[model samples]
Target: MVRVPGAKVALSTASCYPETCTTAFEMAADLGFDGVEVMVWTDPVSQDPDALRALSDRFAMPILAIHAPCLLLTQRVWTTDPWTKLQRAREAAEKLAAPTVVVHPPFRWQREYAREFVTGLARMQDESGVVFAVENMFPWRARGREVAAYLPHWDLLELDVPATTLDLSHTAVSGSDALAVCDALGDRLAHVHLADGAGSNKDEHLVPGRGSQPCAEVLERLAARGYAGCVVLEINTRRAVNRDEREADLAEGLAFARFNLAAEAAT
Candidate 1:
């Protein structure tokens, strides 16, 4: 096993206090994270390159990656056209000097967009220097029935995409082994959303080691595989009763990442 020397540990801006992306950067900086993953949502500053760059400078934290506005709440962000949204995300990444832009597959209802997803993604990668890391989403469960919520269903191994972002939370929700999925992904796994989840249909982004998923084991495997990627702490801290608890969670996530990716561990 070839252990990675030093995989970066970043915090996702959307991890806590969805009020503004600035809080994410501030919390990460205070917790001594290596950098941050900007999740562009309804926050106007999230979509503005100049503002994002300014925040990075102010916090002295690099923007490791940019998550495109792809969630249900961000449907009306850049433009109604999914392709346009992707293009704008790429531009933002380029301006921010972020190497990757994480995106989600279109919804099942977006037939036309889904049809061109694979090819379009490849084309975008070729045209833009930034990597378009497609994220895995969970199925929509309702009335004791399971339905494919995403265009390509949460598994990217079957897809011919160039890169992938594996989220442990999503894996747990899918009731799949985290290690098995990481093995299946191989080199295509370019980014990671470091969170844990219980075996539930709901998408719960629990902090690492707090859930049943082998979050630490997965990190060790990534190190052993010499995976050079951005590990962003993407946990949902909405349940945090106060700022102190929230800060503690973020600090724990960062420490866990550093311990697993330390140079001594790799050696």
Candidate 2:
């Protein structure tokens, strides 16, 4: 496990119920999170920098990162043009004072976008102060048939991306070792989506330590290596019975991060 002393532990806004984006900021602040990653999607406020900045001020939690509206559900957030969406996300990041923007690779069908992804990403990073951290996505499998869902696959070591958002749940679905993947990432690792999965093809965003991923060790490793990136708890609590259950799950994930972080310091 890597020890990242003084690193901020943030909560991805998408980790909470999709009712309202501000709900996430409120919960995160109440739970003692140092910052938050705003996942921009259909929520009107998420697309508005002013609104987000207001919430950040109200909660006193900084917007650590901005997740671009790249998922299928968010296809209509900014614009149909993938490049435009990225640009909008970058603009939002700059407005919110977020340092990183998390994005998913293009789908296989978007041949044109995929073709220019690497080069375009480079240009964006060169043009902006923010880092475009491409996130790892799992493959789609059905009836023993596997489909290459993402342009760069779930592992990003080969991509010429300057930075990456290492998602533990995606690695679990990809059947990749967390430590090995982190090792390969090295300096390119700019952010982390802290979650867990049961090594199933399903993208189960389980709480840290609830699945097969070495969640604690990974945290410790980050601490030990003096990682400066923000650690965002991106777990799924949609299956929770109620608000209390969701709060409990999120609390547990935060506690896990804190404990491992402290343990690393001790060692």
Which model scores highest in lDDT?
2
| lDDT for each residue of candidate 1 in 40-81, tens digit (9 for 90 to 100) | 888888889999999999999999999998888888898989
lDDT of candidate 2 over 1-267, digit per residue (tens):
433577789999889965478989899988999999999878898889999999999999999999999987887788989999999999999988999999999988778999999999999899999999998887788788888888855568767789999999999988888899898899899999999999877999899999999988888788778888889999888888877788888999999988886433454
Candidate 2 regions exceeding 4 Å error are 1-4, 262-267
Q: TM-score for each prediction?
A: 0.95, 0.95
Error of 1 at 35 (Å): 0.7
**lDDT on C-alpha atoms for all candidate structures:** 0.87, 0.88
Total colliding residue pairs, candidate 2: 12
Q: What's the C-alpha lDDT at position 242 in model 2?
A: 79
